[model samples]
Target: MTTTATTAKDLFLTAMDRRFAPEVGQGDLSLALAGAELLDLLGARALTLDGDRVVPGAAAALGDVLLDEASAALVRQPPYEQVEDWLWRRGRDLAAAYRRALQADGGLSARRSGRLGLGAVRVEPVDSPARERAAARLEAAEPVLGALAAAIGIGIAADTEAGQAAVPAAAALEDEPVTTVLAAVMDAVMELEAVRRRRSIEEAAFANIWRAP
Candidate 1:
């Protein structure tokens, strides 16, 4: 299938657009986007990981601003840092940056609405074919492509059968460490989502803690 997605961010967003609700929480998608960025860097040979530490590879610009920024950050660092620390701190921002980039690229469309005098905005795919092609690519089952599809499927919809089917293929990727780190990143994303859910519940409880007696 032909696709416009030349980078991991494009594929990640495309997958989200295809499978998730239009109003999916930004925090949840952000975690996936961050994982996509890391995967792109690793795929491009612009970065590498030493054990749990991410190391800079050859200096090269990915052209995409968010990717370039990530590459530059890795290069500026001494040599390496724990993957967990770097991912947790940088993932959300990277996701936001990619969203902006998507808007500029005309791959995403924004909509505005109001209900009961309250305003809301949301983003969705501008072109359906882009996402369809991305989904087809995910099913291609090539080493890198399959690994990516599995990692992303796990991150966003591990409870679903599709996600489960993608899992075993991840082990077949040439870089075993990449699969390991990708799993770690997915775990971090799940952790962040859990935290968000807890925070929301806590806030709701607090808001109703002192009801009118």
Candidate 2:
């Protein structure tokens, strides 16, 4: 499983493209990105799954800078972090981190618009082998990526008009660890949505009380 392209990176690319998964909220996308990193760590043999807990293996400097950072951040002790816990901890603002990393590597380019072409800048992915590979994976509906993308509302329908996978990609995965991570990501994402809804309701209620006076 010596993969050069990372799931996190692919997820970022997909997020950037409006055609892939538009309307994805940052919180859910961040959780999925963290899950993607964890999956890559599993593939790289830098970590192993003990039940739903993540067990750190030997610290390896995975060639990607952000991945190496993820490896260094692993909980290297007994009572290792649970998959759900890891998603919350590592997933906080993870999307912005990937965006910055990609911009640094020229993987992203900002295009400005206006009469003088200097108004708001829209960030887009650059042409690179990494992006090409990620696009290929999405189009082919590679299970791990398809499941992750699906978790964040990006569907296999992005690839096919029939939108018929027979079964959902996540349910169809044979890889237990990958499946576990995907499930955790989905749960965390749902939890995040619930939290946002609660906050929004509370805010609205508070505003209404002030208006009543």
Candidate 3:
């Protein structure tokens, strides 16, 4: 299993493994993935956190297209993008983008099955070194990755007692930059939940009004 890859890629593969789980939102996953990219970049010293604002370092080709693209996408000017803002902007439809990238790279596959019946296809992870490496990290509770996966409500999370117990790796991530990204991911998830709930309530109220003739 290859250890050298984007954390977001690892997290994405792990999440898709739990694809049948309930309440896993694509938008939230996207946000978490974006945060993962930042975390990975921080680890590479490709960038650093100036408080919540991201300060870009010297450009480096990260050997991964997505990671390189993420580096290039950084706001180079003053008053650079904050963690939360970067999450929303980069997270937009990011889940699908990741899926496409992975599928193209043969990290993911679509199999037509009877589950959805007829032409239904299910996307599954290929038996690749990348997938194996990600599973190993999750299995070992690798701190940043475990924390990132959990933030998206996949694998283990702080919300679960076992997740809390399992992640000594999570505890290892005590540095300011790591904590900053993790906290921002959690906040973004909460905000996304609030948005979903608000829309649900609004739709229900609208239906009530429509029926109130």
Model 3 per-residue lDDT tens digits across residues 1-213: 222478999888887774323446789989998999999899899999999999999998888888888899999999899999999998899888888989888889888868566676667788888888888787677788878877877674446555565567688776999999999999999999999999999999999999996
Report the lDDT of model 2 for residue 101. Answer: 84
Q: Candidate 3 regions off by >4 Å?
A: 1-4, 19-23, 113-120, 156-165
The residue ranges of model 1 lying beyond 4 angstroms of the native Cα positions read 1-7, 15-23, 112-119, 128-130, 141-165, 204-209
Each prediction's Cα RMSD?
Answer: 4.7, 2.9, 3.1
Give the alpha carbon lDDT tens digit for every residue of 111-193 in model 2: 88688987987777888787778777776667888778878887546346424651364467888888899899989888888
Give the 10-residue window scoring lowest on summed lDDT in candidate 3. Answer: 16-25
> CA shift at 147, candidate 2, in angstroms?
0.9
Misplaced by over 4 Å in model 2 are 1-4, 113-120, 156-162, 166-169
TM-score of every candidate relative to the true structure: 0.73, 0.90, 0.89
Model 3 TM-score on a 0 to 1 scale: 0.89
lDDT (10s digit) by residue, model 1, range 58-105: 888676677777777663467567777767666656556666777777
Q: TM-score-based ranking, best first?
A: 2, 3, 1
